[model samples]
Target: MNPRLLLAIYLAITLAPLGLSAFSGRPARSLWDELASGAGMLAYAIILAEFLLSGRFRSISRRIGMDVTMRFHQLFARSALVFALLHPFLYRAPSKPPYPWDTTRQLTLTDDLSAIASGVAAWLLLTPLVLQAIGRDRLDMRYEVWRLMHGLGAAAVAALLLHHTLAAGRYSADPVLAAVWIGLFAIALASLLSIYLVKPVLKRMRPWVVDSVRPVAARTWEVTLAPRGHGGLRYLAGQFAWLNIGHGPASLFENPFSISSAPAAGNRVAFIIKELGDFTRTVGRIRPGTPAYLDAPHGHLCVAGRDEPGIALIAGGVGIAPLLGILRQLRLDRDPRPTLLAYGNRVAEQIVCRDEIDDLARHHGTRVIHALQEPPPGWTGHSGMLDAAFFRDHLADPGMREWLFVICGPPAMMDAAETALIGLGVPARQIICERFRYD
Candidate 1:
């Protein structure tokens, strides 16, 4: 599950077809002709590989981290789109049917309508697919609807590319190369089946019920869930899950949220949710005992077995959800490692669990520092943004370089904090971040 090993596997899978085709013993074409085929073949394999990089597969995401996995997914999709779009336009030779003299297709491209149509369909579909994903938040569509469209559209593109490759590709005419395309396509389809059919069926056996829902801070609610007929989720403190309320296990009405409560708090699980969407704004209306389902323990933000001498938890607004779980877990276990919490907010009302955080400082020796951009009268704690000045003033201590730094917040704040930390001589690996929005 090492990141390097995963990347090696990916390159092997994506480039294997190209390598095989180059050595297929076919008659050589012009250099541009070979490059054209290489571009298309690599793009096709990358498209099929997209199925496994959906962020649902633990074997891949757990090692690379969801943030990196999703970022790679978006960036790689654009790369494939470029290659596919220019595929047909790259050829310089005249388009013609295969002749009796050239059995290996050294001088001709496939001219059959079936083969050409599939390629054209895939080429046209790849454009909107990438564009929609890039503009998902701005588009006038529900997240679930967009997710469905993405999955179905990707499947359609992959299927068309499969037919196009087997029927029109010169090297793919070989039996060995043809089998590789079919096998990879089958693996791609199977990954979709696992996400939609197989995982949902398993979730039905362990349903959950809404235990409670109440206001925690401005426009934020704390929702709790308990197992209905099974043991509750066995997850680490800083992990997350996809929660579906009043929906069947197979439904797409789910959102990913971090666990705000520690595992030591008992069988129930809690989430700190901010009202940012249509479904989230209805959180206070959800009644206790409503049916729910969870696809959980899906993040790599935990520090359970780390050897670091100290830990630092940095938060910005609702990003404090998972960090609270980590702090609570450390307190419950009577962990003696020194801890520091630097929580930032826009105003006083937005500082959630204020008293509890203060208690951690008083009782557990947690150095809690509150930074407010819009502090009230007579503000004594750190004020202004969590900028380089704030990081230098509080975390310039030599010991901070060795502590594990966990951060989650708005993209801008997270970027500033990371930059400040690195500039202050902290190693990149010592800092951990989890970004939910691939954008």
Candidate 2:
């Protein structure tokens, strides 16, 4: 069966109750209404599960073959905000006039003051989530800030949601639905606690030692790590690992870095780090053998099971890290499939792993095309940014869309390349891209 078909079936099973309720012509106390309400709770539970289960989320997103995970995250957050707004209005009865201390004594689900406080908290959380999703770039908020805010917002929403669930008493009136809601909340809480608390504690106990830091360029550094005992995680090529240098084992300061070295190279793992933030900028400052922790081997950028006749890699800056790993894997595996690399850099000097790329091209019969914005006086390679004209000139058979195109780069470059390909009549399914933003 098609993976998408299975996903549709799963969604129907989880949300059919709500659909059934919409068609029922009965009061709130009727069985159909109760079933619909229960199904609504179940749908929310599924959303919560999606946020908690990292493995399942990754698998499903990869299977769907789109950036559905991120889209779902945005959708779930927006829906939660809407629910937060509706929960207060629906659950709380209108204020009753009473001769209290002041003008009009407003009655609430909980005490009026407590209800107001929780509502304010929920608003504070939901507002930022909506703003961040809509205007993330305009806010100039750093990736770390965004991540921290997302976590805080999720916690606040969960707390307010729990308060509403308990105070309303309608959903809780149904024992099974209440139990399912509680179970879902418990799982979300536990998963978050494990990631934030337990994981760091474990890392403090078993920290990997940083062996060396080598400069690949002025802005890029390769940090090597050796596990204290059994070594860090064993990962395939084209995978990424999060590195926490100065923080404790469970610290959220970790940043994802692609494994620059191939897995076949041995026990030590190396990450090619670009100076993108405070954590990455200080990477070169840490002395060799300093204790560190890694959470790794994530991402689905591998070509393990792919059977394409040819592969084309388009990379910009540090986005080349995963492509490098893929190339190294191909070299080690001795695969003779034709490959082409179109690497873009600001200047000739900023081109990373140039020698290694050239060597791979020579050995594996791959073609390397260097596209630079500013080539030096003596430079002879292609100049200017990669655009439609560039692809039109270099790519063979302008109409054929069968070849796989793997793109990884800065947002603008990736957008340009994607636009160029689509303008040339390339099918959307034929183009695969990986956005490398940390958040």
Candidate 3:
């Protein structure tokens, strides 16, 4: 599941169709016509690859990190859009009746109305699909609704494009290439089925029940759950899970949340979620023992096997969820590493588990530093945003580069910290960061 291996596989699958088309032994066509076909073929392959890159697969997302996987998905989608948009326009010739002497009809494009209709339909459908994904956050629809629509739209577009390719494509007339397209489409379907169907069915066999939901901070609640029959989740610290509280295993009503409690805390897993969405705003209303489902142990932000002598845990607002799990695990293991926690919130009330974080500092030797943008009167712990200045002033020790710096926060703060870390001569590999923004 190495990132390089996944990338190599991606390039091979995407380019193989183009290679096969080029060597399909078809009669020579105009360069522009060949280029047009190449664009369409490449675009289609990339479009199909997007399903695997959707972060539903642990091999892709966990290996490369969810943020990187998602970013690649977005980029590949746009690339496919560009190629698809120009696919038809790049052609130089129109369909014409083959001359009596011409056997291959290389001068004419496919004039099949059925094939053309499918292509047109795919083209029309893909435009809004890409646009909707780009503007997903701006839309007012529920996340689950958007997710379902995106999946269905993608499937329709893929199906239409497949028909158009097999029917209209010069190289796709070859049996081998046609089968390759079918195989790629099948893989896409299998990936979706694995995520949507297989995983859900497995989660249903070992369901969970909510233990409690209590307000821990401003607009934030600590929701805990216990496995109904199975031994609790065995995930590493700093990982996350998709929790479906009171929702069926097959339902798309789950949301991803980082595990806030340590693995040593046993099967009773906990999550610190804020009121960011419609489902989360009602976290406090869920009664005890509500049936829940978990598709969990995702993410790669943990430090279980690290060789660092120290740990720097920096978080912003609710981004502290995963980092708390890391810190708590370190405490439970009686780890001797020097630890520093820099937690920031807009106001004092937004600080989650303040007493517990402070207790980790006293009992486990973790230096818990809290930063408030709007600190109360005569507050002394650091103020304003966790900008580059804060990182430079606080984490500038020479030996700091040897420590693992785990950071999760708003995009701006994470960016600033990354820049500051590089400026401080810390290698990028020494830093672990997860962005809280889903979009």
| Residue-level lDDT tens digits of model 1 in 97-130 | 7789988888888778899899999999999999
Q: Runs in model 3 with CA error above 4 Å?
A: 97-103, 436-439
Off by over 4 Å in 1: none
Clash count in backbone of candidate 1: 0
Candidate ranking (lDDT, best to worst):
1, 3, 2
Q: What is the lDDT of residue 131 in candidate 2?
A: 65
lDDT of 3 by residue, 389-411 (tens): 89888998888988888999888
Query: Whose TM-score is higher: candidate 1's or candidate 3's?
Result: 1
lDDT of 2 at 329: 81
Residues forming the 10-long window of minimal summed lDDT in candidate 2: 102-111
Candidate 2 structure quality by residue, lDDT tens digits, 132-156? 7567767776766877776766766
Where does model 2 exceed 4 Å of error?
Answer: 1-26, 29-50, 53-68, 86-120, 132-146, 201-206, 398-400, 422-427
The candidate with the higher lDDT, 1 or 2, is 1
